[model samples]
Target: MELINQTRASLIDYVCAQIATFFPDGADTKAAITRNFAEAMGRVEKCFGAIRPWPAGKFNYLQSAQYCLFLYYLANTIWRNDDDSGTATRLFLLNKTLNGIDLFYEIQMPDIFVLGHSSGIVLAKATYGNYLVLHQHCTVGRNYEVAPVLGEGVVMYPGSSVIGRCRVGDHSVISIGTQVVNRDTPGNCTIYQGDGGELAVRPAGRNLIEEIFRV
Candidate 1:
């Protein structure tokens, strides 16, 4: 529902801007604008079916609507994540580059945090697990050559990476500037290898979302 609301607001913004030219008025054009908005949403629904990572014989529009919106917003949310700060709830925020498909109007991201974008980030795979977090310049490729199976509460910090046939266990952290290729991590572990050496992995800060979105 959180992601749904976020994406809904995004849809309003997108559609409003689109029709601003033709229906720029107080109440005179409100009805017409509303109609246009509905049509736009339907188009987005179609694109959602195409871009989603999984393939199905049919789609549940309502469920897909909820999911598609998250992907749409994540692709455009810059870099953001809802941090838990040692809490049991694991939430994710993200940007546009973390999708396995070329997003047109629909791009569904994993409901996890993606710290940085606009630095050549790309997700070309489909077998990712839940609670996966990512940073700038990371790439999850296609096929089992390097498919990542992230565990619960996995974090990928700045310049960190997990590429190709990697399965990280629960509560594992990939530290800054580290590149993991064809490897597996155990639960409750910190995988860091940077210029600063390996920093201790902690439950992410509380204001991580606001930090990423700068909202």
Candidate 2:
């Protein structure tokens, strides 16, 4: 997927402009903002490569929501390290308002944590894997102080959750409404809700990432 395009360039410029509003009239501040914007743009582009033609239009609801979520992550990263406290605070508030997800947790942006929508998702401070695709209403949170360590190519369907100190292996699927707590799952498996609301784990029927994404 082409990451650098006219639309993406415009989107970057738009976000930079919004960020600049919080900075004061000084050359040093301007330079810092420029550097931060470049870094954020690079990370966001790298992570969102599978979803090409980003910064979608208003009508493209799903893509647009994803775009907003990406912006939130980028802003959160910048807010963490930037010296301008006021700018950081403004961006943090903006991110929370747009995505409605808790920003108190840490997110490793190198791995593409693909969010299907901006609503009904809560992510805690967990070790997320590469190509993590999370549908709406999914939650990956902590149990007490420990969080799940997810492997590559993990997909959590709508209403599914993997909470507590669990280890979800690569290519594992958490089926819709399946809740996995404090369990270790093997690679290439699926966790689904069985009879009587009991959760069952089995080998995955397909490689969902291979079918959907180029990676």
For TM-score, the strongest prediction is 2
What's each prediction's TM-score? 0.44, 0.75
* lDDT for predicted candidate 2 compared with the true structure: 0.66
Tens-digit lDDT track of model 1 for 1-215:
12243354465454345334433443232333333444434433443333334232233323533333443443233222222121101001221222332332222344443333334455654454444556556665544544577765566676666777777777676776677677777667776663543334344334332333212
What local distance difference test score does each model get? 0.45, 0.66
Model 2 regions lying over 4 Å from their true place:
1-33, 52-62, 79-89, 103-105, 195-197
Pairs of residues at least 3 apart in sequence or in different chains that clash in candidate 2: none
Number of backbone clashes in candidate 1: 8
Poorly placed runs, candidate 1 (over 4 Å): 1-109, 112-119, 142-146, 194-215
| Residues forming the 10-long window of minimal summed lDDT in candidate 2 | 53-62
- Candidate 2 residue-wise lDDT at 84: 59
